[model samples]
Target: MHLRKLIPFIGLVGLCCACVFAQQPAATGLVDAARGRVAIPDPTKPPPLTNSVNDDQRRPRNYDMQPPTIPHRVDGYQIDKNFNKCMDCHARDKSAFTLAVPVSPTHYIDRDGKALQQISTRRYFCLQCHFAQEPVQPIVGNGFENVDALAKKAADASQAGKK
Candidate 1:
């Protein structure tokens, strides 16, 4: 008797499920459009390969702790285990003659804080920290404000509040 009642209940559930599934629309809008299209590259024309031009004009640092960007082109400048062309111009003794800013005195200190007569190997690679500035559009939008700008805004607000 119980089994006969359970059979009708199960049948009702299956019918409801079938109705729900039947009412669902076909996945045919964006998916169907994408499936019908073939993304083919232009075989006759090649994509342009352009090199970024370095900005020789010195740009001011946004913050005090920021590393200065290279103000000149550094392409083909050798910086390897055997040779560091940067030292030829930026070394302490050579800076006066070359008119290039010398590497920071801190670069002469080792990891243990021992001062060496020569630039510590830890800081030998100039390009590792200093990169040439290139004029290029930012890939993404940013509303970032510098520390000085933020500070000035706060100060201005405080002064207005006092008045």
Candidate 2:
């Protein structure tokens, strides 16, 4: 009976020790030794910048380039069992001759090479993979230039970089 009563106290002390050990400073001077403390630097290094891409950045090339970014705002768009905004334009049946941009041919193929005429229930939500965005103004400054025309320029750049 007495041992059972003491079990909670022992557990509490062990937990307190664990907390203290976790707070103790490391040998690396990056951490402060006293007050069981460490210091952290403010305003960490900025993320590396990628060159801005326009529609022209999409091109036919030997190797795959990065996927093009979504070009419009996607916030508050429904992308679930209840609704999907993307199909109004890109559905295989609707896009052709309907003033809708046709979906990529890749979208039609299933893993088994069968043409999945209907959007898979798993992929019913278009926003899961696609998003909309607008060009952001330069936050600070950069000298980067857009290739502006992907179909012709990508091959040259890739070839030049290789050589």
Candidate 3:
């Protein structure tokens, strides 16, 4: 009975110690991509908000299974438990008339893998998986290669090795 009463206190102390230890200086001199050189305890001034790219042109996906990015600005769009403004144009039944790409069929699948007539509650929040492109400079450089590019490079290397 006493151990059970003390368990919560012990867990709290352990969590505090873990947080302190986690903030110790990185031995590898790695800088946080988001915070840059600022220490963990220091407050960072956020960059100014940039305008979203609103050309309505679909950009290429960076990787496999990447959710499509919103091609238009979604400012002032209402997304709440009561309503989803995205469904106005992107719903399957309305996309043809609106000429907007329909929400993928996968969005209709429930956690149990059963198909629902409407968008699954789990996937109703479009912004959770999709983001509108912004024309802002990246804070950190990336050297990401898509699977298609990697596969083509491997094929070319094999052909060169045979020659």
Candidate 4:
């Protein structure tokens, strides 16, 4: 009957409204919007907008798109070892051997001009700023390709052609 259809339609409207206004509780009382008391958030829902991977799981910023992912797990590496795991691959001496780019020399310089022997404690937590890279999956419906990877391949091809 039409009444049955109306029941589902009414339920869907309520569900939508619930999602649209839900506010998290803080030390203060229930967060509320102008329209009504906000409904509870559903944990089953995928994260809402502005939610990307956790900051801990994500890579550093200010780099070109699609940097390679970190290969080793950093779970309990001796951070006291001068952020040593990261430094091993990303240091002035070992970068060439590890085939990894060293941390920028700027990272070694303190706010003062002097280069410190170790990574500053401020930069010691690798996950704080940098993260293992992730493969690029388009967030929207459109297909996109990374130009940098293509450019690198073209350069390699040109070099091979010359030889």
lDDT of each: 0.77, 0.58, 0.89, 0.59
* Model 2 root-mean-square deviation: 12.3
Predicted structure with the largest lDDT when compared to the true one: 3
lDDT of 1 by residue, 27-112 (tens): 32222232233333323343353454565566788887677888888889998888889998989999999988888889899999
Question: What is candidate 3's CA lDDT for residue 136?
Answer: 86
Badly placed stretches (over 4 Å) of model 1 are 1-55
lDDT of 3 by residue, 1-163 (tens): 6999999999999999878766764755667788877887789988988889999999899786899899999998998988899998999999999999999889999999999999999898899999998888788888899889999999999999999
- Name every residue pair that clashes in candidate 2: 72-132, 72-133
* Lowest lDDT 10-residue stretch of candidate 4: 43-52
Candidate 4, 135: how far from true, in Å?
4.3
Question: TM-score, each model?
Answer: 0.66, 0.41, 0.77, 0.40
Between which residue pairs do clashes occur in model 1?
Answer: none
Candidate 1 global lDDT = 0.77
TM-score of candidate 1 to 2 decimals: 0.66
Q: Report, for all candidates in order, the number of backbone clashes.
A: 0, 2, 0, 1
Q: How do the residues 7-34 of candidate 2 rate in per-residue lDDT, one tens digit apiece?
A: 9999999999877775554633334322
lDDT of 4 by residue, 80-122 (tens): 6534677767776887898766776666777767888866556
Q: Could you tell me the lDDT of residue 94 within candidate 2?
A: 81
